[model samples]
Structure formats: C-alpha cells, structure tokens
Target: MSNNHNPAKPLQSILAIMAHPDDAEFCCGATVRQMSDAGADVTYIILTNGDKGNHNLSITVPELVKTRMKEQRAAAEILGVKDVIFMGEEDGFLQPNRELRRRLVRHIRKIKPDLIICQNPEMFFSGDRYINHPDHRNAGLVVIEAVFPAAGNPMFFPDLLAEGYEPHSIRELWICMAPEPDHKIDITDLLDVKIQALRQHESQFDDLDEMEKWVRERWSEENEAGEQRYYESFKRMKFD
Candidate 1:
C-alpha cells in the first residue's frame, strides 16, 4: 500500500492556454497573479502569432509575428509565468483539428498541470456586445478536448509515449469570460498586478487611458457581483 497524504503537492503546476497574445491577460490575469503568489508554477501556451491584431501597423506577417512574440514574452514575464510555448499556428485561421489536439495533449502531458485555464468555448456573450473571437472559441474547444481523453488516455497519441510524454489527469478547469460562471477567485490585492501585466502588451493597449478605464470598470462590476473587492470569475467545466 502506498502512503500519500499531502494534497498540495498534486496542485502545484498550472497551465493557461489561449489563442492570442493578450487573451490570458484580458480574461484571467488576476487568477494567474494570485496563483503565482500562492507558489503555483504557471505555464502558458499561446496558439497564434497575433499578427492580424494590429490595424494601423504597416508590418508584414513575419514581422508582425516576431513583434507579437516579443510582446507575449514580455507579458508572460510580468505575470510571473515560468515558461511559454508557441504553437506556430497561423493567426486568424485556427481550427480545431487532430494535429492541434495532439500537440496540446503532448504539452499537457509534459507539464502535468493540476489546473487549466482557458477562454470560454461557447458562442453566447454576457449581455456585452463583445462576442468572443472565433479563434478564442476554437482554441478553447481544442484545449478542453486535449484535457480529456487525448492527454489522459494512454492509447491515444501513441507517439507521445515515444517522446516521453506521460498521461496526466488535470484536477480542475476554469473557463474565463464564460456566460455562466461557477467559480470566482478573489483578486482584490492582485488587481493592480494584473493591470500592470496587461500593460506589458503595449502594442494592444497603446490607448492606455481607455484601456485602464475599461479594465477598472470591468473589475468593479465583477467586484459588485461577488461582494468582494475584486475577483476573476470562471465557469467550471466537468473535469470527470
């Protein structure tokens, strides 16, 4: 009989997988900051180059990709993320395919994250005219699929075994910007940290005044809804 009583050891690693450079910051920044402060190791896997994000820049695809990658690395550093992986998928054209799932599964197996955070996969918006982006939805769907049988099943993705990737069962999944949220993490003290981290992506938030106002208002609304100072809300998915 094996004796294992410490539960905290199993919950150390966390993974945040998103479609674009700023998706994680916009959606779950506070949660990431809180988890990092709590000593959890967080890793990010970005699925796109975010080359199509800029509207005014006269940059080519390769140039834009390089710029966005640098921005993403800077943002990750500000958020205290330990590692980041890029999928090298084309921006604005991501699809939920077997290849993507396999790659995601491989990473999940290697990282063995206890908690996975992602954007909402559903189409409905939360009374805000801002519909979630298509790439966000696609990435979320594939991430959920990878967290399931793909990463946990030994028979699936057989090549991963040869690559030394083992089966990993994630304990919980939190989907940000979900229409219906079931879990809320109090981020009262971490709100500023989150904002500073988001500011690292200067390419996206060149209009700092407007972005700050928007984030403050949004966080205020979330605070009112939860009766807390600030929090990151999420809809918990069925993990079993």
Candidate 2:
C-alpha cells in the first residue's frame, strides 16, 4: 500500500452495495474516496432506510428514516460518490430473497460498474464480540448473488431487459471487513477526507471525535503492518 503509482488507468466505475445508511462510511469510506479522487465513478446502493437506528424512543420510524437518508447523502457527497440508490427496505428486517436479488441485479445492470464493493457475506460475528446485524449479513448475500449469475444471466431477470437494462458483467468485487483480505489500498493521504465524510453520519454518532479516534486506532494497526501509512483492507473476488 506504499502509494505505488502503477501508471495504470483506474477502473472507470465502482458500485458499493451496503445494508444501512452509514455502513458504507464505516466500512470503506477511505477506499471509496481514494477511488473517486483517482477519477473513478463511485456509486452507492443502500439496502435499508435505517428506520430503527435511533436510541431516542420518542422519534418515529419515518422521522428516523428521513434523517438517516439526509445524513447518508451528505456523507456520500463528501466522498465524491456520483450517485446513491436506496432500496427502501425495512431496517432490522432484511431478508435475502429472490426479490432482493432481482432489485440488486437491476442496479448492477444499470450501473454497469467495473468494481462492486460490498460487505463480507461470512462476517456474522465481530472479533470485538459484537453480534453482526442480520440486515448487514442479508445485504451481503444479496449483493454477492446479484453480482454473479443474476446480473450476468439475462434469463434470470427477463423483465429488467424488457425495461432496457441489459445484462452487465462485473469482473472485480471487493468485500469490506473480510476476515481474509487479499487487497489493500493506501489511504494515508485521504485520512482527513475519510474522517470528514464519516462525520456526516451525525445522526448515528454522538461524538465525532470519538468516531474518528476509533477509525484511526483500527486502521493504524493495518498501517503499521502494511507498507503504507494508512490502509483499507478488502477481500478481492474476480469473475474472470
């Protein structure tokens, strides 16, 4: 991750599919920013509206959804994301099903991205002993399936084709918070941008400084072990 300028052209487009509003920011904001700065078109597909992400018992679900959506848009803007798509699924009740796969496939075909970024499908338990949310896990599975035969095979979703969305194949996929990562990006130069982008999710966090400190502490370990001052890790999957 030593800022190795390969002189190779960057991938043209990237689509990040995640569970909630802040999932993209918490998991891969730095990496997304780095890609955008390098001239890659970055897009986000948020699965849920994050209706239940508040501890305030007085707030209504609709109110929380609106607030979270606004925060997520602001955060995406900071990262230079080209577009944000919301699936509008219910929070905390996500299920990996054919409908979810179809919707995800439709986006994949429409976006026609070279790289698809998403959460790790296998990460059900955190090393910190925190139980991973089922919605996150569900989104991961749906994304993985959507990136595969569902998106590439026209027969799987013929209606999408009728709507003018042709099958689009994605060759490279990256999984965030993967237990085994084979790829790493140096984000040292963009740490400030990443922290700032993450701060946009103000609704989810009470203390921005504490969140920033947590990010530094987590990435610092990877930075020290790798060849870069700061790095974001990913498990790379290749279709070809």
Candidate 3:
C-alpha cells in the first residue's frame, strides 16, 4: 500500500500491448503513471488503428485512424511512455494468428521488456454484462503466446533469429481487468497524472463531461470496493 519506490533510477522496462488506442488508459492508466513516475521506461503497442471508435463523425477510416494515432502518441507523451507502435490492423476485427504472433514476438525480442501488461482473457464476468471485447481477448491471447513460447523460444521464430533478434524472457506480466488478480500496484499519489494521460485520448472519449464522470466513478469504485486497494490488478502468466 505504498507508492514509495526508488524514484531516482529506472526500475524496469515495461511494454504494454493493447487492442485499441484508449484500452490501456482506461484499464491501467494509474499503474502506468506509478511506474513511469518511479522512472520505469514504458512503451505501448496498440494492435489496431482504432478507426471504428468514433461515432457520428464525418472522418473516413484512414483519417480517423490517423487522428487516433496522433492522439495516442500525445497521450503517451503525457504518460512518460518512451515509444508507441501501431500494428495497423483493422479495428474491431483482431485475430490471434501466427502472423500477428510472429510480429509481436519480434518486437518482444527487440524491446526486451522486463515486464509486459495486457488485457484479461477469461470470461468470468461475461454474464454480468462484463463481456470482453473480441479484439481485446484476441490481443491478450496473442500477447501471452508471444511473450512466452514465441518470444522466449528462439526456435519458434527462426526468421527473427536470422535477423539477429535474440530470444528474451520477460520477468513478469500484469493483465489489467483480470478476473483473478495476484498483483496490485498502488497509484494513489499518481491518480491526477493518470487522469491527465487518459484525457489526451480525445478521440475515444469525446464527451468530456461523461468521460470525466465515468473515470471518477470507476476510480472511486476500485478504491472503495472491499479488499481492493487503489491499484491495477493482474494475473501473472507463470511458465515453468
């Protein structure tokens, strides 16, 4: 329950993989703030162009994608993220395929992140209207696969090996919105920074008033909910 980490030095390099532009901000913004504030290098890889996110807007698909990417880049700057990568896949239609997995593995090996953050794949809350997005689930599965056997196993991607991309093992993974959370990061001191970073994604949350209210309510719920401290929750993928 303490936000006191060694702030003078970088603790770890974190790579966050998500399906859309604002998914990370909505789910793990506070955790990102905490880690960045403590000098941890953070990078984000958005799997889709987020072209379908806008409603009642006159922009074309390419234009919307461009706009969202710009917004995400600005948001990353606000969150202290070192780099942002877009996979250029179509929005709302992601699939966990070998091609995507290979691409992710190459980046994983290149970045060599100490930790990776992603969305949950389980369906525990589906009945209660907490149905996970198909794109999110697919991305989560791909990320898990890429982080383990694909990225960590050099034999899995021989093309990467030929290109001098060495296999790298990540120390840990944090899945935001996990059905079962084994890790919690305290973000009380960095809540305002989280809000600011999230606000940068103007394309996703166009209604300023509604977005602010929703964020506040969610934050309050996460804090006041029993036995759940103000933190980002995740289930670590343990590979032996």
Candidate 4:
C-alpha cells in the first residue's frame, strides 16, 4: 500500500469511467486537471444520461438528459479533459450486464488509457446517513469487469476485433470513494478549479454559494500549520 504516486510509468492517458454527469466533477476534478496540466490526455466515460437527476416534474426525461450532458461537457472542459463520451444508459438503472460490459470493453481497447479512475462497487451505505446509489455500484462493477478478462483478452470480444478496437491492457485503476484507500493525491492548490468545474451543473444545484461552502467544509482539513488542504483518496491497483 502506497500513498504517493505509485504507477511505475508516468501517466500518458487517463479515462474516468463513472455513473453520472457530475460524478467525475464531484469525485476527481482537481486530479484530472492536474494530470491534464502535466500533459496527460484525459477522457471521461459517463455511463448514464442522468435523466432522473432533477426533481422538477415538468421537465421531460429527454430534456433533462440534454441539459445534463451539456453541463457535463462544460465541466469536463473546465477540467481540461480531452473528450467526454456519454453511454446514454437510463438513469438509476445501470447494470453490469454483458451488453454494458462489451460497450465498456470497446472503449477501453480504443482509448488504451494508462490509468482508469472509477467508482467503488462495494459502497452500500455511508455511516448512518446516505445509501449509495445503485448506478454507482453497478458502474464500478461494469468497469472492473471490462478491464479484466474482457478488454485485454482478444477472445472476449471477437466482434470488437473486427471493429478495429484491439486488445489493450491498462497500467492502473484508481477506485474513487473506496473504503480502504491506499493512495491520496494532494490537490491543495487546485481546490478552486475543482469546485468551479462542479458548479457547471446548474440544473443540479439550487444555491451555488451553499454548495461551494459545503464542498470546502467536506473536503478540506487543517494541516500541521493550521492551514487547510484538499486531497482525493483512492484504492489504487497496478497491473503487470
């Protein structure tokens, strides 16, 4: 277990596989920005359209999906992400099914990313307050299944081979919100960028100031010098 940067090779490309539009922004925006600044090409694979994210009954599902995708694109742009791919799965109903796994495998082989940052599959509940979203857990499982025997093994998806998405093995996987995180990336200097990226989800948050305040309070901590700092922790796994 190592907290410092543990990838044997410098990251050249990164792919964030997540459940919803703002998932990447809320979880790992600053880290993505930092990596992009350091010359890594970063792409986001949003597994769902986020159609059920809003409480306004007046808005149609199609309308909400469009709004969220626009917001997600803007947020990824703020984080300097190279591309954002929306998988358009129905909101609140993602699954680690064979169909979804094949789709994810196609992307993994096509992107050939050095690092894949994803959700945590086993987070069922948080303390006594929040029940983890089903989509989140399923999203994590989808990525895990794809990254294993499916994406790297040519035998798993013979059709993808014809599509020219060759088998590609990843170097590392960083699971966000992991219960036993062994790696923590300090983003003390990039807190503003992280919050700014998240604020792009206008349809999701009613009060920008309140959201910003909550985020700072939730993610910040006092250092030995009594100065506040920010970091995102993950369970990192390296491959052979």
Model 1: CA > 4 A from native: 1-10, 222-228, 238-240
Name the regions of candidate 4 deviating beyond 4 angstroms: 1-8, 223-226
Candidate lDDT scores, in order, read 0.82, 0.86, 0.80, 0.91
Q: Determine the backbone clash count of candidate 2.
A: 0
Clashes of 1: 0
Model 1 agreement with the true structure over 1-240: per-residue lDDT tens digits: 111213545447889999999889888887776667667899999999898888875677787788788888887887878998999888889998999999999899989998899977786455667766789989989999998878999999989988889898898888888766887766667778778878878878669768977888787643445564766788875454
Q: lDDT tens string, model 3, 65-166?
A: 888898898878888888999998988899989999999999999999878999876643555667678898888888998987788886898999999999
Of 2 and 4, the candidate ranking higher by TM-score: 4
Residue 60 of candidate 1: its Cα lDDT?
79
How many residue pairs clash in each candidate at the backbone level?
0, 0, 0, 0
| Model 1 pairs whose backbones collide | none
Residue 62 C-alpha lDDT in model 3: 84
Q: State residue 59's C-alpha deviation in candidate 4, in Å.
A: 1.5
Off by over 4 Å in 2: 1-9, 222-228
- Top candidate on TM-score is 4
For 142-207, candidate 4 gives per-residue lDDT tens digits of 999999989999999899999999999998999999888888777888889999999999999989
Q: Rank the candidates by lDDT, best first.
A: 4, 2, 1, 3
Clash-forming residue pairs, model 4:
none
- Give the lDDT of residue 214 in candidate 1: 86
| RMSD to true structure for each model, in Å | 4.5, 2.1, 3.1, 2.3
